[model samples]
Structure formats: C-alpha cells, structure tokens
Target: MPFFVPVGRRLSAALGLCLALLCLPAFAIDAAPADADPAPIALDARRATISLDGRSQQLLDPTGALGIDDIAAGPPGLNWRLRGAGERTVLSGQTALWLRFDVLMRDTQAHWELELARSGTDAITMYYRDAQGQWRVQRAGDRLAVSDWANPDRYPVFSLDVRPDETVRYWVRVEHARVPFSGVFQLHDHNTLREQRIHQQFVLGAYFGMALLLTVVALANMAVFRDAAFATYAIYISLLGLSMAASLGVGGQFLWPNLVRWNQEAEFVLLPLMGLVGLMFVRQVAQPRRIGRTLDRLCLALAAAWLIGIVWDQSLPSALSLQALSALGTLSMLTIAAMLGLAWRSGETWIRWFAVSMVPVLLASTLPVLRNFNLLSSNFLSQYGIVIAASIEAPLLFYALLMRSRIQHETQARAHALERTEPLTGLTHRPHFLLRLHDSLVRAQRYGHHSALLLVHLHNHAEIAARHGREVADRALVIAASQLRAVARDVDTAARLDDDSFALLIEGPVKPDQVLHTATSLLANGLRLSPRLPAGTTLRLRVVAALLPDADSELAQDAAAHLEWMRQGMLTLSEEPRKAILRLNF
Candidate 1:
C-alpha cells in the first residue's frame, strides 16, 4: 500500500496481459512426427511438444465403437477433427481425444520420459506395444486415485525405450468432465526430468512457505487483539494456500496421497470458503457504519449465500456446481471491490491499503475464471497464477493487517490508561494502586528486592473545610499531593488511596532510616498551600513509613497488615507534640 503508484502500474500491466490472453482463441496444434515414407526426425533429451492435428488425432466415442486394432492399423478415412489451429485445443463433453505421434530415438541407450504438464484433466492413458508385441497401457490423472498412478509423481509421466532410427507410434487418450480439457505434452530424459521436478517443487514450496508465514502472523494478531478480522484473514489465507496446493498437485503428492477423494474435492471446497472468509474480512475492516446498513446487509447475505452454496455445490451436478462456484467467486470479487471503492470515497485509509494489497489476487483470478468456463486455454499463468499472486499478496496484506492491529492496540492502551487514572489528582486511583502494590510485593518477594510503603493522612483537612470552605480544603489537598509528588523518587508510584489519604510504593534498597527521613520531609512540606491563606490559617499532616520484607518471609504474606499498624501508630502519636512521622518496620 505504501508505494501504491508503482504497484498499481505493475498490476495494470499484468491485468493487460491477462486480458490479452483472454481475448485470444485456443488453437489446434500439429505435434505428430512425419509419416513412415518420410525421413525420421530424431529427438534427444531436450523437451519437445507432440503436436496433434485433424489428421494425427481422432476423437473416439465413449461407447468404444472403434477398437484398438482400428486405431493401431492407421486405417484411412478416419473421422478425425481439429478444435482450432495451433498447439493448444479446448474440447468439451464425454469423448476422449486420442493423440497419435511417432517418437524417433537418436540415442537408444537413453530412456525418454513423457510428461503431461497440464493438471485438472480427468484421465489420461498412454498405449504402446511391448517387446512381445502386446499393447500395454499406463494410466494417470485426477479422475483416478493417487495410488492408481504408475508412478507417485505430481504429474502423469511415462517412460519409453526405443532403438536408434526406429520410429514407434504412441497413442495417448485424454478425457475430462465439464471443464475444457487440453493436454500439453513434453518429452524429457532422466536428467532433464529430474531438474524439472526439482524446479517445480522449489516454486511451489516457496509459495506454500510464504502462505504459512502469513497465516501464523494473522493468527497471532487475532490472539493478541481478540478481533474477528484477523481470524477471518487467517482462514482466507489458509484456504488460498490449500487451494493452490491442490491445484498445483502438491496436496495429492504429499499432504493426502491416500485420501484420493479429498484430493479431488479440495479445490471445489476451498474456493468457495476463500470467497466467504475474504468477504467477511472485508466487512470487518470496512466498518458497517462506513458502508451503511443496506450494503452491509448485502455483504452478510452474500456470505450466508456462499456458506449455503458450499454445501449445495458438493451435492449438485459437477458442471452446474463448477459454474455456480465460478459465478460466486467472480461476484464476491466485484462486490468487495465496490465496497472498497465506497470506503475509499468515504476517506478510509486502511480500506485503501487493503485494496492496494488485493491487486495481485484480483489480477491473478481473471484467467482462471476464463479458463474454467472454456473461454481461454490453460497455460502457465492460468494454472499457477493464483499461487504466484498469493506469494506477493499475502505479505502485502500482512503489512496492512499489522498497521491495523497497531492502531487498535494503541487505542485500547489509551482507553485503559484513562480508566486507571484518578481525574482529581492526575495519579493512579485506589483500585489500580492496589493492583500495582500487589504486583510490586510479588516481585519483591520473588527477587529479594527491598520495598517500602508510605501512607500520609491529612489530619487538619476536615477542620480546614469547616473553618474556610470545602473548596479551600480541596486546594490544600491538591497542594499536599504536589509536595508528595515532588519528594517521591522516579521509581516510586504515588497514588490517591482516599479523599484525604495518599500512598507511595517505593521499590528500594533504602534503609529504614532513609524512609523515615522522606516521610518527615513530606509532612513538613504539607503546610505549603497554593493561594496566600488568611492570616492565622494553618494545616497539619501525619505521615507513616513501613519497610517491607526483602524476601519471601512471613511479613510478605501480610503486606497489608503494616498499613493498619502504621495508621494506629499515627493515631497514638496524634496527641504528642511534634510527632509528625511514625515508622513501622517489618
């Protein structure tokens, strides 16, 4: 949020790219090798695309009308079709796309690995004849359980061995439900494949780690501040991380390899919940008063609707459910944007900060929506865009949250400070002073620190009020408080215990003689009044000192016992002349 202009420019460029991608149409690609009569194209360990065209690939019906013999024999006049013109193609419905390609090996000693880069495909099966001339099939995809895959890798991979100059035909069958399906194929040898896996893991692991850090920080803020906004944000970020893990295949590979059903259902469940919690966070940061009742109610209603939708989505048809969830996500985005706009117009600086923080996610979510409805092809950005965006957005939002939490903490501290203060004396009140004294005593007994307590009683306060007025007596008390504060050390806490009584908690290594000297000085200074008093007006003060135990001794448990003893000692000496200071050592 702090460098908004630069971030806005970057986001504009990214959003422009997303729009350009959305505007382009999916293309049909030709990745098939040359015919048998033509020269063979040798392939090494480098990655290469296996393109498919109307002539190279054919769509087969779900009824299995065309058998493997017909597909293998390369029969003429086959009903093959192309979805578009390029390497990428988007297909819908229940038919399997069979891609046939020839792999000519240049190095027979090296093994070639085939990888399907695109995820979200329902099922993929590759068919190739073995050395015994028997057709063997290798299966992989989200449609099947994780345990069913040939290898426990993140993507669908297959290994192939071929002799040099030998051309072999391979058939890959791909199928999906509801969503547009396209398989981006690549061939990598052992070393190349290993590097690819390592690179992919690094990218995903970094993103996941960033999300985890943000989640912990948000949860901590919630604990300290007791605010629902932080809690909602924590939930939203956690779902975002989980959704990425599921989409990027990290969840299936590591988190729940055996829970195949959860792997399949994670994205569906997490996306809606992210929307719900995200909207709740928005409503919390932008106070209801700022957004007004109508719009606020609308936000709450939308949140409830999403909650119901999450339940209904699981039960409804997959195609309908996907469409509904996509719609819900898009709607939530627009509504939150509008709410932020309203708050910004109303001059909410924190709202602007949040809006700035959301730029990456807003831009990243666009292509995924377009791809979901078959308007765009699945590519690098569309597949991992949200995850990448979250790596940046989470930290920025965390900064914004830190700012908000700091403001809240500072405000609460101010209110608490005021509540603990006495308005008349500008000092700690009786209740809060008792708490301070208790804490000090606890620390003194635990740490062996010397401590002293001083109690001052204005003996002439009532007499002064009867002679002059209550206002004059109040002025005399104020003057006495000033004198006590002037004599008290910086480490001591001076508090008003009652109308005419003041107490001091002196944390000390001071001797009992020093405490008695300070008490004598306070009683001598109490006669100093603010205004020039009438000719014969006078004031009297009785001050008492009690030295507490330096360690956890018997007197530590009865710290309050000395207060009554000091007061009784002062009362007993009230009749004696010039007995202004009383000392009770414990």
Candidate 2:
C-alpha cells in the first residue's frame, strides 16, 4: 500500500468514527430503566412546568382491558404501582396504561392549561373534576381529527379551573398498538401558554422559511445552470419543509385544514420522498465517478426501496410503514456517512465541505428516530430538532452548492477558451486569428486609421516535429510565440496562422520603415532555444510585412484586397527560399 493514498479515505474513516459516536445519544435512551421513576412534582408555583413520567402513579394492563374509571374505583386484587423515575417513560407492549397525578393550585386568579407535549399517541382520554365538582372528559390524540381538537393546538391542551387550596385528581388513560414514548407534561397559566405558542410559531416559521428559501435557490440554480443535481436538491428541501410543517401541526391547522388524512400521513409521505431525492442529490454533488460505481448503485437501490414504501403506503399498515421509516432513516444516515467517507478517500475535496454542512441536519434527523425507538427522551430537541437544524444547515448547504457550481463554471469556461486557442503556443488558432484579422481590417477601413500586418513563417516546424516528437516541437513553438509577444505592443494582435506560421497585427499608423524594422528584429531573434533542442535542429524564419494602400491606390479597395496582397507576397517569398524578409512599401 502507498504511504499517501487519497485524504478522502482517511477522512471517511474519521467521519465514520465521529458518526458512530453521534449515535451514542440514541443508544443511551435504551439504558433508561423500565422501572426508573422521577420524584413527585410539587405544585410549588402558581404557574409551573413538570414531567409526569415517574412523578405520577401508573398501572399497566397488557390486555388493555382496564380503563381510567376501573383504575380509580380500586380493583380489590388488581396491581397498582408508582411509575419509576426516568428521563422519559416507555410503556412497552400492547397495553393500556393509566397515569394519575394530583395538582394543588394556590392562586385563585390563575387559570391553568395542562398540555401533553407528546405527539403520535394512538389515543389518550383524560378524566378530571372541574370547579363545579362535575366530572369532565376530554379526548385528544392521533385518533381524533385536528379540526375536532378541543383547543385547536397541535398537542392536547386541557383547561383547568382549580380553586385555591383545593387539590384536584387527574387520570389519563393511554392506549397504543406499539411501544409508547412519553413526553414532559406541562401545567402553566394562560400567559405562559401564549408565550410558548408564540415561541413555537417563531421557530416553525424560521425553519419552514429557511427550507423554502433553499428550495427556491435550488430551483433557480437548476433553471439557470441546467444542473440536474439542483433540481433533486430542490425537491429534497421541499420535502423537508413539508415534513417540518406537518410534524409541527402548522400545516394541518393552516395549509390544509380540510385534508385530515394528509396531515396524519404527512410524515410518512414526506420522509420517503426526502430520502429518495436526498440520495440523488448526494450522489450528484459527491461526484459518483470518484465515489465508485458500486456505492453509487447501492444508493440508488436504497432510494428506490424508499420510493416503493411510499407508493405502497396505502396498502400497508401504518405501523409497518412507520417501522420501515425508522429502519430506512437509520440506513440512510449510515449510507450517507459511508459514501461521504468514500468520497473523501477518493480525493473529492468538495465532499469535505458538504460533510461539514450535513453534520447538524444529520444529528437533527437521527434524534427523532432515536426518540421513536425509545433510545432518546422525547423533548423539544428530539421532536423539533429537524427544524432547528434545518434553520442552521440550510444556508450552509446552499453555500456548498454555490461553491461547487462556481468550480464547475470555471472548468467549463477554461475548456471553452481552449477550443479557440492553440494548445502548443497559447495563442488563438488559425481560424480564430483569421476572423480577428478580418475584423481588424474592416474596422481600420471604416475608421480611416492606418494599420500594419507582420507575418512570420517558421519553415522548419515539420522537420523538428518528425525528428524530436511532438513534445519537443510543442516546446519550440511556445518559445517562438513568447519571442513574438515580447516585441509586440499591448494593442497588437499575435496569433498562430497554421502549423508553423504566425502573424501580428499592429493597430496604429506605423511607417513602412517601421514595419521593415519590426520584421528585421524578429529575424535577428532567430526562433532558437538553448537546453533541450536536438543538436542540429534549427528553424528558418520567413517574414512578410505590408502597409494597406488607400481605396484609390493600385491595390484592391477593400480590406480583403490588402490581405490578398500580403498572402501573394508571402507565396512569392516562399518560392524564392533565399529571401529572409519581404517589406511591401505602399
């Protein structure tokens, strides 16, 4: 193995290690004890926030046959236990769990709002006594439509009117088909609740606005540059925005209030689409050619599988789709990390910047999955991390795209410039030079300014090319062009007329004597090199100079006629072989 392979591979290894460590937070969630419980939350303030995880009493019935009423009635032999202390409570298995807590408010003027900060719950029914001693019931969860929600908030909000010095008992019956991850339950006054909602809306708007801006920028890049990668990136960003909006409940409440089913299934739809387009965008930007064909094909296959899951979502169970989503999300993150590492190893420097840009979003994308698997506690960071990360990562990704685009544009421009240039001499080619010469002649004729043309022919270029190969021949031509440029003025046009011929057009009223002097100087320079030329290889210079006559002179009236006269003089000089320079004195 070589000592210095590509830096990309080494970076890839480092990135893998870093990402593995990143997954630790997710794994830490599983380490939380099933029986772990936090101490009871004391109602110490008129407005306060608390987690109901282990602070409340919990009774789990695996059969899900026990209701809140049954639990409150005190089953003679039924088991009733206090919930264990933990950062988050995970009620595993298909069961009904009843949680009970008592709240004592000291301020009579304080109107309480109890909010369950968790989302995606299958069903949650609350039992509480109001101020009039009437038992009231409130139903809220994924099972109910957003429009039918009691408070019209994304999460369930229960208004409480507890009298001063009065202790009220609350029971919540929770049922889920899969493992349920509990969140922090908060109790606060109207002002606190309003402030929180305002904060949430601000975050959501920033997140969605950033995503929208990125999408628009990507689309504009796609349209202007005709890059397919930008189009895919645009789609990816759009899906991310949709996912954020739907998950935050803003999309349901505002964007599509009538589309209840769409709101419920928004995550399922947007994530898969984001995954698919995200893979495509990664492949394109990372330069699959350098990352290896096998890896590229694998990314495509995974993207295709995610697409299939999205298409078949209607026929499959929601749980199956959700499970598939978590699996694919983890897989996608791993795959991206691997590909980025491989890209770095392959010597793709741009991928390094991209890797840096993806860090926040990668962490954001993983936290929710970990929370879903009960590997991380559910909170604002886990639930809304994508939006938070997107707000930061969007601009960074856009910068990466811009950098990549600029590099591509420069590369294309260089290639286009080379097409009109002679590679050996670094000067315009014969056709391009001729067009310039004709244009110069036309301008001089129209503007009534005198111009001088100096043509030099290297008669031995063929012998040198054949004897020493093209590399040596190319060096000799470059040397000759350099000599021509050194003596030419800044406004003068210097070009390669053919394989061994060169020309210079001086844009001024130069005398015939001046043209003769310029031609003589080039002859004396002798187009010769020192170190690398073959011992006997030498170049013979044939020079021709002409001063264009006026429209009334013996020569033809047009610029074409002046060019013909110079060409004829060069041909005549070629036939002589003995002539070194021909000066046409008009």
Candidate 3:
C-alpha cells in the first residue's frame, strides 16, 4: 500500500526535488497538456547574468530536505539531471551540468535528448534532480519512452574517445509542465515547473498570512481600546495586505486580476497609509515625547501630502510627496529619542521594542520615496516595507497593550477602591467628596460659580439611641444613606464626615434662586425615616447649609477649612423647617 499526503497550491522548482504524495490520486495523468509533444530542441550556450545582485542556487534531492518540505517521498523520475551547490548540494556522474530558467510553467517540461553519434555511438545515461535536493542518475529511462527505441540512460564509462579538434553536440530536451505543489497537494498551472516559483509562493504566502493576522489583531485592539489609532492601524493593515498582494503580482494574477492597472496606485496608497496610521497610533499612546511630537507632526504632514497626491494623479508628484518617509526616518530616529525620554520618565520595555521595530521599516519606507524620485533603484526598496514591518510589529504591539493594561487596570482598580468608598455608610468616601469639591471649586473659580454644601445632623441622635436599643438608630442612618444615594446624580458624592454628621456637596453654579429651589427639594424629604425613627420621641433632624460663589477659592479650596467656614455660617431653622437655605458671595 502506498501512503500519501496533499498539497494546497503552486510549488516552485527551486532545485527539482519533485516528489508529491498522493492522498487521492488526481486521475488525470494522461490529461497532461495537449501541446506536450516535444519539438526537436538544441541547447543555446548562453547564460543570464547579474552584475552586483546575487542569484540563489539550491541543492536538489527527491526524498525530503527539511521538515517543512512539501514534496512527496520515494524517487519516481530521472532526478539526476544537475546538482546545484546550496543546502541540498549533490554532485553526480562525478560532475554534471544544470538548466536554469526564470519562469517555469506547469503545463510544460524541458525534454532532453543526449546524442552519442559523434562519440562513436557510446551508450549514454541520463540523470535528474529529486525533490529532496538529491541528484538521481538513471541508466534506464525506458518506462515512459516516447521514442521508437528505448533511449539509452547512460553509456559505459570509457565508451567515448575524442578525436583531435573534434566537438560533439548533445541534445537534452526538458518536458516540464506547471504542476501545483502545495503541502503535498498538486494543482494545474502552465508555469509552476520552476524552482524559484516555490520560493516565491512561500514568501508570498507568508506575507499574505501575516497581513491577515495583523489586520485581525488591529481590529481586536481597536474594539477593546476604542481608540482611533488602533482602528487606523487596522485599516492600514487591510490596505497593506491588498497592496502587497498587488505589488508581488499575485493580486493581479490570481486574486484581483482586473486590478492589474491599479498596482502602482495601490502601492501609493498603502505605503503611506500604514505610516499614517502608525504615526497616529504612536502619537496617541506615546504622546508628546521629544521625538514623538516631531513624528506626529510628520505623520500629519504625510497624511496631507498623500491626500494631495491622491487629488492630483501624476506619478512624479506622487513620487515627490512620498519622500515624507524621509520624514519618517527622521521621525523614527526621533522616536528613539522619545523612547529614551519615555524610558527615563516611565520604564516600559515595550516602548524600547516599539522604537527598535520602527527603525528598519522607517528606513525601508524611505527607500521607495528615493526610488520614486529617481534618487535610487526601484528594484530594492519596495511598497512591501510596511507589510514586512507590520508583520513583525503587530505581536510587539499586542504585547505592549498587555503590558499597558496590566499596569493601568491594577492602578485604576486600587484608586477606585481606596478613594471613593465611604467608611461609615459605604457610600462615596471623604477622599471622593474632597475630589468632587476640588473639581467643583475649580469650575466655580473659572466661572464665578456658586455652589452649596449641606451638613446634616441627627438632632438628639444620642437621646434616640439611648431610648431605642441603638439598632433603630443604626436603621435610621441606613435609611438616610439610602435616601441620599437615591437622590444623587451621576456626579454627586455623599460622604459621612462623623457620627451622625454627613456632608452633601451640591454643585449649584446656577442662579441663586435655582440654588434655593434645589435646597428646598432636598430638605422636603423630612429625612423619610419618620416611620423608622421613634414615633413620639420628637427628635428633630435638620439640614444646615451655606452656599458660596465658586470663585471664592479661599472659602472652597480646603475641604476641612472651607467646610468649617460654611458650617459656622450655617442658616438657622427656617420657619418652613426643611426649607432652610443661605446664599453667599464669592
């Protein structure tokens, strides 16, 4: 029984380690391309060259190379053609020759015919490269022979004798076709037969996968933080994914075939867009650090420039404006400065990582700007910088968010727990009351505002407790706290200052008449504990308050000091009893 696996997409022929495991055989071997009939071919002894740029040469073996290998096991064809010197380097027939092509198709094969006529008809052998980067030479190539006679795979070792000044020509034809090889799965393509195709697919797939992940991460961050910066970054990632796909020619070829013409424009938008969002996110989180302010300003400028570039669709203008990435480099350098500042002011490790991640990418973004303006070559610096940077960046950002939230929420929970709780009534505590007072005082000082503070006492609260087991007195206090809480606004903080004495800070920047009216409403409740208190004890519960203009800083700044003054100036019992009120000038 033969075991097998499945491949998903196109595979490149980096070194002809062509082994694909069949999970379910794709019963169409005979359906090989109709034009596969080979034409008598001859080798042209010409080689392509690159001056400074380097070309990659890899090894070829069929079984397996590394764990990530997607090709199948067990040799099937004559794989001993040529062994290149890379990771899978294999030398065969002691030494051999190689065939290199730029773009290899799936439906095509490089068919070779080596002739021995000039060499005295010596028996010659054949070889090819396997999927595991190994060289496999076969002296028997007759299984699927399309020739009338079984082609000689190899000649005996000394079968060839050379005459002086005589040269013999050998014919080697390749019957190669584009066959998709993704994770042991095969598909059809007229162009998948090249070694480089596999490499390109892996690279493209990694980028697309990363872009998608970053996009998802950005959205999740935004939803949690509700910050525009995160949302902007998310949009940038999505655009970047599209942009990268387009730039790599994959989007035009497979995904968005119709949008081929928009490739440059997509690059234009995505390149700057990522920076725009990154700048915005940085400005928001890092704030006005020394370099941060500068970067933020630069981002703002780039956004404007991009908008302008979009409005006027000329390549040069578009090119010139993107030089803003030069600004990004300067800006990113400044970010380093800012990170130093932030580190000194607040020790956050994530800030350092963020700073480091920005450098290469910011530099990369600058490259395209230079290239677009003819300052450099378009071949090196690409629109894919952000995609790559973002690929590495998103995880760092998520870690940063975790760090930020971990510390932030811990501090927030502590402050809320300690400051806002009332000791006696478990209501808003003295600290919270003081905070509210300070805020109200500041507002009043700014606006010449008038506000009121009321001090309430359980009149004869000791006498009532003396008569009622003290439990009823506790009940009365509970009732009062509940009533005050029920009447409180979202801003109000009610606090118990002492036994039987509570302070109510009421914001009354309104007219003096409205202040008086609001006071009347509060006192009208009659403490509501009449039923909970002694029926005939006749202990009076009264509210004593003083209202002062908020601008009276000296009278309102210190809670104990100012409140003491207000208590001293408390109004006596008005004839209406509960309606007692007083108004003062700042």
Writing each residue's lDDT as its tens digit, candidate 3 over 1-586 gives 6452211011111101221221112222221222222221222223121111111111233333312122223235423232111111122222322222121221123222222111111122333343455544433111122121233211111111112222222212211111111011011121222333476577768878877887787678667755555676667667667656644545544564344235325545555565556555665666654544655565566557555654454344332344544445334434434433454344467665555445445444544444333333223223345456656766776666556655666777666666677544676666667777777777776777666676666555777688887787776666667666666666666777666766777775656565455455555564344666677643344566566543535554666676666556453443445444454342
Where does the lowest 10-residue lDDT sum fall in candidate 1?
A: 47-56
Model 2 per-residue lDDT tens digits across residues 540-559: 78888876544455653454
Best-to-worst order by lDDT is: 1, 2, 3
Instruction: Report residue 190 deviation for candidate 3 (angstroms).
Output: 7.7
User: After TM-score superposition, what is the CA distance of residue 295 in candidate 1 from its true location, in Å?
Assistant: 2.7
Give lDDT tens digits, candidate 1, residues 325-347: 77777777666666665666655
Off by over 4 Å in 2: 1-47, 61-80, 84-95, 145-147, 175-179, 287-293, 388-396, 439-473, 479-494, 504-564, 567-586
Candidate number of the best TM-score: 2
lDDT of 3: 0.45
TM-score of each: 0.72, 0.77, 0.39
Q: In candidate 3, how many Å is residue 314 off?
A: 4.6
Model 2 TM: 0.77
Clashes of each: 8, 10, 74
